[model samples]
Target: MNIELWWPKLTPSTRVGLLENNGDAVPPQVVAEVTRAGGSAAIDSDSEESDYYLSDEDVEWIETVTNEEEPTEGLILSKVRRT
Candidate 1:
């Protein structure tokens, strides 16, 4: 499944922690906290629409956040595939 996370802004430390251990799925508590912080996570599908959207840069930012230790900015977009 494709999971997209949209947030106004997140601290660098928080971004790393979010993807450190969790794979494929993010913890519910994290999701809840993000929601409280004006963020949202939703399934990426052809039919269903999400309240939040990510731009090309936003998508690339997520890739950098997940793959590198360097800090990133803007929204978070993570795509997880289940076997």
Candidate 2:
């Protein structure tokens, strides 16, 4: 599955700058869980879609506080997959 992770703030996190800030990274445990469930995880700085697909549990976690209730029309987000 294609997952889009929204980058709320633009900072520098990874060596390649894939993530803006290390503080905004998704939890490792979450990645492990997704992998264990036969899925892959990747981080993205930009995504175009508004809707996403993931397990119900993960979905619940995804729709958490972005600190900004305002909509992000063109901001980038992370992406995960179920391999």
Candidate 3:
């Protein structure tokens, strides 16, 4: 599977260097997901990222990565305990 990266949106004060500079470019969840799925991802920092994003599947995986305290698949149900 070919994965495309959507760089994170730049904040108002984020403009610090040349527009083409990949150094300050934000890494999106696409990079993580592609890696997690056992595939390689290509970064296209020049491309535009939309304000609206994150499909259902994308959201779930992003959460898993941010919350490093838990594993991805078992994360959700692991928190729910029987009363």
lDDT of 2 by residue, 1-83 (tens): 32233222222232123222223444565455545545545554365543222344333334432322322333344432212
Q: Candidate 3 regions off by >4 Å? A: 1-51, 69-83
Q: lDDT tens string, model 1, 41-82? A: 555455364433333453455556556534353334443322
Per-residue lDDT over 6-35 for candidate 3, one digit per residue giving the tens place of the 0 to 100 score: 212322122122122222233455335435
Error of 3 at 30 (Å): 11
- TM-score preference between candidates 1 and 2, better one: 1
Model 2: residue 3 alpha-carbon error in angstroms: 9.9
Clashes of each: 0, 11, 0
Q: lDDT for model 2, please.
A: 0.36
lDDT of all predictions: 0.47, 0.36, 0.34
Candidates sorted by TM-score, best first: 1, 2, 3
- Of the candidates shown, which would achieve the greatest TM-score relative to the real structure? 1
C-alpha RMSD by candidate, in order = 9.3, 13.6, 13.2
Per-model TM-score on C-alpha atoms: 0.38, 0.25, 0.25
N/CA/C clash count, model 2: 11
The best candidate in terms of lDDT: 1
